[model samples]
Target chain A: MSGTRGERFHVGTRKGIFTVAKVGGAWQVVEAGHVGDNVPIVMHDPRDDTLYAALDHGHFGGKLHRRPAGGGDWEEIGVPTYPDLPEGVEEDTDASGRVIPWTLKLVWSLVPGLDDQPGRLWCGTLPGGLFRSDDRGDTWELVRGLWDHPDRKEWMGGGADWPGVHSIAVHPTDGDRLTVGVSCGGIWVTEDGGASWACRADGMRAEFMPPDRAGDPRIQDPHCLVQCVGAPDRFWVQHHNAIYRSVDDCASWQEVEGEPTHFGFAVSVHPEDPETAWFVPAIKDEHRVPQDAHLVVSRTRDGGETFDVLRNGLPQEHAYDLVLRHAMDLHGDGRCLAFGSTTGNVFVSEDQGDSWTCVSTHLPPVYCVRWEGRASAG
Target chain B: MPRVAFTPNLQRHVACPPRDVEGATVREALDAVFAGNPKARGYVLEDDGALRKHMNVFVDGRPVRDRVTLGDAVSPGGEIYVMQALSGG
Candidate 1:
């Protein structure tokens, strides 16, 4: 699969979800939907080739839709919903004393379950709620273990208005094992299929937290968490302020420094190479533009020991593209990669991070990109 | 029975034409309207059954006072308008 070609993909932008395909050696947006709406997340289920798009209509609220495997009309599906705030619980507050309303703010992460669990789907949402759907998003129920954890109450938002679980990684072999990355809530792992959870973020530091609480795993934000499919024990995270790599199934982490900058949002691991991964670094904080007004993707071929800033086909002059956490994705072949930026530019690389091709320059602000994988589009 | 009609803007996402239903309050009227049009329910109200902050409901040209419970009284022959606030965008 590593030698395969880049074919079709989807980019979820601030305005719509576009279906981009490589037809006759050229990339084009073959189809587009929700043309003037906010689509924050999209998922291409390789198991069934099903495409799910989460459209957050600012006024009408968050909505989810999907096209079945063989590709059909877009059908509206149920969004992850939170149960009613229990009666008499008017003051549902987090540790920071902020009222965390029981509402569906936005769909941050939508992932399909392991191969064995075909009908199962996992969803993460803002205000920090993890949900499970057994019917391909037709219905959903909130998972209580992670939401009810005592430490979750202490989880506060980092760069967002509310704490959210944005990244969810399901174990390739163990369907019961799952890991989730919260914006400011650290990393939580569950081996009992969401029945219970444990915080495994030990060495990740948070410069934004107080000196005494800087190492608190419950509040140390890991912006994105990705596990190496080839080496399941290896994991990498683009933390809020630093980059860390874990080689023990997230049991511990070691800080890895970036060259131009150490802060960024997106990270992608090679399909079968634990020593290879890519990241998009930014200036961090108040100014989120690319470092030195140059957009580049950094690649680590030796498991974080060293990195090469690849910018052959990327913009290097006065470019302000911030690749979001969910905006970058790699095809199963690893050589075929793509990532979109907050500026609405979509770039693809057929030869890994060696070079890139700009697919679109004027779409909505890209929120997520899902590359077509090994599975057939059917 | 009161008549419930969604703002025209909603038709683009979900079709919710005017419907006549028996109800004494805004919540009941909406509940009756959503009974047959389940797809439009999430577009109008939140999961907890509260009216969306950006969506306003009016009964006979008056905005409902109780947004949470939608308990504002609705006259038997009153006309209900579910309008998306202009500022909501």
Candidate 2:
């Protein structure tokens, strides 16, 4: 499952976006764009072959930029704006007790629409706003159903003053069915486009809350959510407290038992096989380093029935890096998997999870990694 | 007309050459500049139209008085410098 020479991966980093391509049996840094800006997500829209980079300028707020398929200058597409608050709804309160208005702080996730709707794009933002664009990236409208949900008031922040929507999984077969994972807000599914959304965090626990409220749905925290393309109903979630697999279109979830550590950030599902998945386990939330200071990727081929740790070419000692939720990705039949860490390490595995190679290490802290390749070739 | 210039550090990210725009107040001068380069507005101001926490604007080498409304008065031929605040480590 070696990658084709010239296959490219767009990596979002703390400093900018770096283009890494496989060239002559080695991965090379082809280009470094958006220098000095914090890039959180880099997505390749298969419908039109457009590359989108979600830039989080610490001072100016977050913005989205797109470049053509082959190569071209990046164009700034406007970031989504949350609509005015409904009457009588109080603004979010910051740690200092100051009232903070709903603002677009960062673009955490970008998901392209189904094949039937090629021009459509879905974006999830900080402060828990879901936006959709029908004209590619021209104009955006906030999905009011999720923004105005009554449970939103209880959805507090995890690392910031407000909760953020970081993972979005659009059903491969049904465009109308989508699932979004929010930090400290649990899992939400929408079956009627943007008209309605319901919580689907059953069986998920939130240990950060009080003992009596640990199992409450409104307090569940999911770090990442990925769906199997071959089986749209099958979904995998790497939660802050544990890992879960949902087989019924995310209507219900059950824990994926017997993992080295239940705490992790990223999750990748096999493109063709719903039974295969990968996760990078850490010590825990407070101590977010590799377990025992040894980095390893855990894989389950039997749909969470059994687990095996892969550390052939990875660091086995004193590696204190944490992979972000969107920093790991699997492309083209799930055989080519790439993941980046907060310490600016990029690792790739062409033979699924058997072996690994460090692609780049001198770049800025990696935020997200995405692969762009043809499905049939792999 | 007041001449507006951006710090070199800010210009490295976004091209903002010195330009003269007709305006009576700091807000009007910034609005004139935003008319030509809308992207720069986000770098300097927040969604609520307040100057960003990490940004500062000076009129004729003096800090602007009004940050929320940006209502500082500007004289003809005055210089406005928009630069990143030197506060964070």
Candidate 3:
């Protein structure tokens, strides 16, 4: 094995953002930022060594802040704004008969733009809108073309009371193309930049939907979506009811079954290996706890040909930790992985799920985690 | 002019000093204060120009009846208070 540049990862928690670093040859919580606040989303822009945290003020609404490179004060930046409804337009309703408000409910996903487009950022939010930032986080503009699509009316919320975009993957080389995974709305792909989008989530099943509409792609909820950087055409979606794979650039999807459970909200693919992926499993539907109270990570090294439930160093009895969609992350080379759960626990695996170690506990409920350093030698 | 004061809790995240702003209604008064302290606008209201769901506004000790437009009338020299609705941990 060769040297690895990755050292730290930021964690978004129910009440603060924490930075854990490799100290004395072991991972330790080294710094805390934005304490005493609800931080639901955190991202590390490796391009510039900056950190972005999204704070949710129960009474004040959502806010975004970016710490510029070199570790300076966090700067409050412009958040995504929803333009008012057009004249004579009626409010839209979701499947549960709730009217989708034209407001920023929460900043769900923050992703750095492609390498070619420096200083560019993409923000995915609830109420289903994608915003693009040109000059880093100084300002942002909602991608209006996709917001006005005719098919968006069919989208609805899955676990949330309203629909939201929780996963975003940019093509490594194509700056104009990307895909966003929306809960209960499936995956939407844009080829001409943000000018247009289409729901290419065919073959995903939604048993939660009415029997007649079980196969409707637009209403399927992809809990999380990830693409292999080494193989852009290879994608994985931890759908609401089962695991799904897309090998044709999301043109189609197929179910990939895992044992003990097929329900979960987080999925990570090996950055350089399309055939490798990992998922945190829970009992299906109403029972979201770990199967029989055993916390395990299911991994597939042969493109779902088989799955190994890795439980070493993980809680295996009466554990109820539930990982959120953005809580699990993998290093660029996929040799190092980390996941945090709502139970306020964080664990790391260095040998790619063969073993694990708990790094922190008794913090706040963890919402998201991202690697802040370069990928390890794989 | 009505005296507008924000919850001290809000002051922790934003500098919201009590002030006398000119307005005939709750909306006008808040709009007056937010005009100079623009950063405080989002802390009090949501994107639709309405009081946040968990926020409350009081005019001279009475709850502002309309949270949508904040249309409740305000006296020339009355006291206005913007507070977070009481919540439990």
Candidate 4:
């Protein structure tokens, strides 16, 4: 009864379907429909057999769904809605005396659970901060302190419509310890499973500052996050203006040393090693240079401290084309990574971003990539 | 062969070097170039096989609505153009 086939990988495109392609091969339609926006996909542990797709509705609202690694139907996990509010109170308050935001927004990283709870799921959202579900897609509860802290409002950027949590990083061994990246607010950490929260942006640059204050300016936009899965203390972040890292668990951060490209959106960490990470860098000032001259993917082995351009089989003397952040990722094996450019070309690398080959063309501005494994192998 | 030059309206964002398609009518020319790039077909034609509401296919500067107008009589060297109709914010 073993149907395990060749090494396979799946990528979700905004075209509303998950395209599965053989490793270093062509893409074929596997699953279609909104697999969720800004969705994060994770393969089941130990075997990487089963896969879970956490559809982050993000600004538009999101849901979680599960499917076999080999591909089949989607089983939607219930998105928590406002459980009826107290009759005498305001319309917004739930029965538990909590105010439900306009919509349930989710743009999160999927954190696998530990111990007896083999199916625990953790995710962060825009309107709902952070949430954890013990039973597979059964129910969910908000992680208490991440966004409910007294200073949460002060930390969230002035422009943020809601205090949103975009990235989630749980300690690989100690599931209770976790880190959350808030788009406009900054980064927050929880040692006792979100029972409390604290700002960890002390060394990170704050992209936005008071009009009168002068600063490095890059800190104003720490938009995306990549947690070193193998190195919990380190992190590689992609901000709107610059790249940064924290070697000591959000305690402090330093800029990725190099000639900066000035703009980028995504970050992909090496699957087996935490120190190696990759990012898409667009040339400085030239809004059209395809991310640093010729669609080059930057690699850093010693965390974000240093980086080098990974270009061997890539095009030379080409038009400036940049890759989007959420548009790229590293499959679990750590040897391959797939990225889609704003130009609608899907590029894959079998040698860990060292080189790439265009696998597909004419994809509608790819937004995210996830891995789905063997359907029955699970 | 009738040649058509596909120029993007939002030239600042779309950097596709002008595409030339040859055919007896608008449909034939577009079909050849878009077969491999199916994701681009939505922006060019509507569900009814009519030109998209926001796009204009010009027969040498004059807009043509009939997608099947093969007798519109395009000469061998005549230049046809496909331009995105611009709109306001």
Candidate 5:
């Protein structure tokens, strides 16, 4: 942290959100808020230096909190609530035939609005609902097009009892265009700012389902999706069964050829380089721990043409931790990449995934990690 | 008035100090408490206004029969308890 001018890393864990900033030459916990609440995601709005934390209360429900940039007490912002079910539409049913009601179980992902829309924000929630907020986190409206899509009936759950929109990517150049990744429903794209949505899982595969339905778009599962900011057309998806790269803005996807293991929960892409990406590969869906109990990060500098395992500082054996879908992140020009594990370990690689250093080992099971950097004013 | 109390576990995420609220039914008693802290209402009840699956309500050491509408009548000086169900990994 010697050259840290304004670098902050927030780790969202099962117990709370931990704020660590570079003090002197090492990362130190400047503040640890939400002491006993489960923080699924902590996002920093770079436009205004505001931080939003999605707190998941097991007994209760999900709650959203925000704080200013420099750090202070968090103010509770109300969580998103779904509107009444459309007339004549029945409640969703699970595999067991139990009717599932619309509830905000968790705020899985939060993305800042386009550059031109100052106060706009987007949120993805469990139970497969996407919401938009025009006034920051104050008031939210559900994206009804996706909610009422015909494919929703076929959508199933991968990790939860119902499908959830866990990844949302707003195009850097086209504010109206965006993509959303669903756990069991696959990839969806809306070019008209959520007025309409279409499934983009044509080439993605879902091997976990029955053979007849494995290739269906609604049954595809994308664990994580990342878009290269420098090349908005290029995107990478860590699918439930394979790794896919799409060059046509998710119109069609092709499996990345050189992955050691085809399964992982997290994917990180270089901020400025569409060709460079990172993935923490684990065992198959049945066993999610690191492959062979060895924790290694696979880096592909040539856009998935080939991959090199980076494990200079990571555990080589008996490491049973798995990184959640949002537990890994890349910041700035991709000079820094950080990831956290369910075993309560956090690691950072400042040199673009060539090596790593342990940031913390005693945190509660980490759910997500994010990086915020402030440039030095000359 | 009924003596309404929230378990210590629920207090971790919300501030719910045991207090007396005037109401004839369980829903009325909870509504009186929610009037003071609107945020806590979302945590305890779903958007459809039903008790969350992980939450349980007890009246005088017995579980309430009407969980959906919370229409169970409260006896005079009855004690109500709100606690989280034991679940999850």
Candidate 6:
């Protein structure tokens, strides 16, 4: 193996499952599912060290299954549904009076329960809204306030899908306090679990729209927002125009100075340190151009106050690129990180994003990356 | 009239072979270049057949957002290169 060795690793695409390989401290896996095309989301459970995958289950439907640490049984978790369908919306009506089935797949924003809430799963769906399970993946319930907010419809942008919640962050210490980012909706926070919620939209602005037009009214156009526990009150937002840092839990923010003033998505933070973070920058505001520049990875050692380009071992130019958020991630150990790109390539860095090596060359546009540490060989 | 060249990255996926397109409209010139190749659609158009967001068609190194009637008139010998915008962390 030329890349890093993996004790345990998993790769998820729209298709199905892939058992990733550990080579030279890098993770790479052959596109394991039937080819053609499909969307897949992959996540790892820290509680039992299990990996759960939500296959393409596109639009309104799909399946949820779990794979063990070493890779064996992929047990089905449960049937996914629109747990919090807005009240007045009629269930599918028919001559049989049976609610017309609306198939939906769980585009989950996963979080493992803390304290005694083991195996607890928190997920958001495509039609938009949140779900929580306390029974170790056996059952689920919708977190009420979040789904029924007075601005729900407005927050969802009147699109066929509600604001798809993709990123969920639960404070490792405070299970009750949490924050989540809706794909098209700005950002929302819950101070006491899901009992009560508030839009943390101070310095945050809508990405798809303009400034004077930014606010809850335009909540449906948020770009991507993520919080770094390393800086409890701080958040990094890759809005439509520039990258912003909010120091007051998103209540307020100041754009971080950088090269990405026009476009990019997928922002991540070092698991242990707040000062360090990574994001994939893309070219083309609206269409895919063959002339994309280098796939650059920017680093901020002082908590996103400033950023420096990391190019030591990366392709200097003609990278043929695009790096997505789920495409890039920091492992349990902050020093090691991995990222996939639209160019069908994967890169790994043992000394952070400072240096890189191509692990795999031709995997379908890698949408997400998930890893598990291989138990150290005695 | 001006001309632009495709980078190596673009060359890998496209068979355009780096050449000048002759037409009065951006769409016409692109149609001529992509004549034999049909796989470059999604990379250029959205699911609805509209130009994808964040995409640009440059004439002589300058960026152009318009896809319907690219403002940069394709003079007899002008060249255009399609590019995906680069922005992000």
A133-231 in candidate 4: lDDT tens per residue? 777656877665654465543433212334456667667678788777765556778888779877776555542232221132212346677776666
Query: Which ranges of candidate 3 are over 4 A from the true structure?
Result: A1-5, A94-97, A374-378, B1-89
- Give the alpha carbon lDDT tens digit for every residue of B18-88 in model 3: 99999999999999999999999998899999887656576775557688888989999988888654211
lDDT of 3 by residue, A1-378 (tens): 112645678899998998887889898888999999999899888777888999999799999999977789998988888888789878766432347898999899999987689999999998888999989878888898778887777676666656788888888889789899987687999998899899999999876543445588777889899998889999999987799998999999989987668989899998888999999999865557899899999999999879999999999888999998999998875778889999989998888989988998788999999888533233
lDDT of 1 at A193: 94
* C-alpha DockQ of every model: 0.01, 0.01, 0.01, 0.01, 0.01, 0.03
Q: Please, what are the lDDT tens digits per residue for candidate 5 over residues A1-378?
A: 213333678999999988777678786677788988999998988778889999988888899998976677789886889887668977766432335578788899998986699988899998889999988898888899998887776666667766788999998878778899987788999999999999988888765543344577766889999988878899999987899998887878899864569889899887677888899998876568887788999989887889999998898879998999999988764677788999999988878778888878889999999887521111
Error of 2 at A169 (Å): 0.8
Docking class of 5: incorrect
CA lDDT for candidate 5: 0.81
Q: For residues B30-78, what per-residue lDDT tens digits would candidate 4 score against the true structure?
A: 6755665555566667766666644546665444636533234455665
Which candidate do you rate higher for lDDT, 2 or 3? Answer: 3
Per-residue lDDT of B1-89 in model 5, one digit per residue for the tens? Answer: 79888866566678998889999899999999999988889888998888886565777755576778899889879888875532221
TM-score of 6: 0.70
Write candidate 1's Cα lDDT for A1-378 as tens digits.
112555778999988888888888888888888898899899987777788989888788888999987678889998888998778888677653447888988888998997789779999998899999988999999999998888888676655667888889888889889999997789999999999999999998866543445588987778888988878889999997788999999999999988678888899998788889899999865467899999999999998889999999999999999988999988887787899998989999989889888989998899999876642111
lDDT of residue A169 for candidate 6? 76
Chain A TM-score by candidate, in order: 0.96, 0.94, 0.96, 0.79, 0.95, 0.83
Candidate 1 Cα errors over 4 Å, as ranges: A1-4, A374-378, B1-89
Give TM-score, chain B, model 6: 0.68
Question: After superposition, which runs of candidate 2 have C-alpha atoms over 4 Å from their true positions?
Answer: A1-6, A87-100, A374-378, B1-89
